[model samples]
Target: MKSVTILLYDGFSNMVLSCLLEPLRAVRDQSQSALHWHIVTPHDGPARSSSGLNIAPDLACKDVIKSDLLMVVSGYGYRQHAKPENLRPLRLLTRQAASIVAADTGSWLLASAGLLDDQTATIHWGVISDFTEEFPKVRPSYERFVKHPRISTCGGASTALELMLAMISEQFGPADAFIASTMFLHDAAQQQSTGRGPNRLEGKGTAQLRQIVNRMVETIETPLSLEELAQQSGLTRRTLDRLFQAELAMSPGRYYQLMRLTHARELSTSTDYDLREIALRCGYADASALGKAFRKAFGHPIRKSRGSRPH
Candidate 1:
């Protein structure tokens, strides 16, 4: 998106704002998009962070012309900031913004403005009980973040980063998101859908499941047998199968294949490895076998998707 308006209020989280902006900065640097943003406060002057940092605004909220994306960020005392003067401008901005994001306590302001009526949303976990009691019509999800086409809400910095990456993936492509995710050293162990079908292996779940997935990642070049996988995780095949199916909605075999293919895709995009080498690295016996599986899943040969890129 070209134009972004970040609406801040007093007592916002400095770290939350950093998490929101840093990923966008990374996307701007990594992608071909001409993304830019400006900060705004409800009235004027500056917004103070919970950590005692003062950030002067670029413009008043009422003066915002338009925004491709509007981000509402706040922390303590967000309810008091939802007075008529602020709500009036927030409602107007929401109607104009193509997409909306509420990070940390900002969802409270959006809910107060009646913007979250009848929508499934989430807020920082600490305030979720109060949020539920305050907004009876809104359906609340305990997800780290709930992202839809028009609006999204998240709890903390890590979830905010995932939300930004999801938006980047939706707008640009997964490759850019992947680069940023890895570059940030984001654990990415989120449990939610993320609006993108996340690799559950790289996400949050039970310790045993994580143990198996870690083994899978480590054995990409020489995939472990299901028997070996189960043994390493200290479980039987049936138990492992049940766990993957129940949690990730897939059989262990299928999840392992997805892991291999996803790893293969990443390697193809980020490196100059030949198909045969990439195939071998991803645990495929040879180029032909890898080609068959890769095409079946991704709808194209790896060579074609690789294309010409920087080494």
Candidate 2:
């Protein structure tokens, strides 16, 4: 039997936890190998998710027994939850467990406990810059998930599943992992092949449209005009507009503006960059110009949008 212990904290993401657990459960159901899991919290009692759903812990932090693997699951308000005392138990677990994994912002907690020092890891992409700035010793990666010796980290829900599937492959075999993936309707090959591009528009439009979208993403700091985009796509301005309308139901200019606004929103929320810096990165003249565009596109102030997210 392979024993796994999951450490849960207040305001942890239930979705992320489910993604990591379901595949393993499937493996246990389908294979002869026994997979056992227990959920634990820092203190004895229940832990509530950000959505207010409470999960009763199987054990308290102090009573947690050694396991084959220990994974910390966390999400919003991680900075506030990652207190010194909360991290002490994790530091102890690092020495006890054969393998350690951090899911989502759980990397922040592990990094705080100094377990990720000199190890490559990743967090959710939305906070990659903030994580990198905060944890200089831990090498932050752009990959969806990173596996190191005795330690691993994953970005978000889907990536968590990917990490678990890969672990299943390592533990049992590729056939067992494939069976588990099939149970979840997950296409492992497609998931492995997909890159972290701007968006998923590869099969939605013509080759020319894909080229134009790729160009827009690559040149967010210096966006091209419609004429330039069309020229690069080997189409005239009118033809580009028609193609976009036919494929995406939006004009080329609107699509371009939406793309820039999306990137700006990501920067505003993920990075510590000021408004002027974000504007320049999104190819606006100044903060004022970016604010107007953002409001027109998203129907809310950038500051308000950023503020809505948990710190």
Q: What is the per-residue lDDT of model 2 for residues 151-211, given as tens digits with 9 covering 90 to 100?
A: 8999888889888888887887654464455433313222323553333332244445556
Give the runs in model 1 whose Cα sits over 4 Å from its true position: 1-71, 118-121, 129-152, 157-203, 299-311
Output the number of the lDDT-best candidate. Answer: 1
**Against the true structure, whose TM-score is highest?**
1
Q: Estimate each model's TM-score.
A: 0.63, 0.59
Clashing pairs in 1: none
Q: Kindly report which residue pairs in candidate 2 clash with one another.
A: none
lDDT of 1 by residue, 183-286 (tens): 34324332222433355433436556655666776788999899988988888999988998886556888778867876776677789788899899999999
Q: Model 2: runs farther than 4 Å from truth? A: 186-311
lDDT of each: 0.78, 0.77
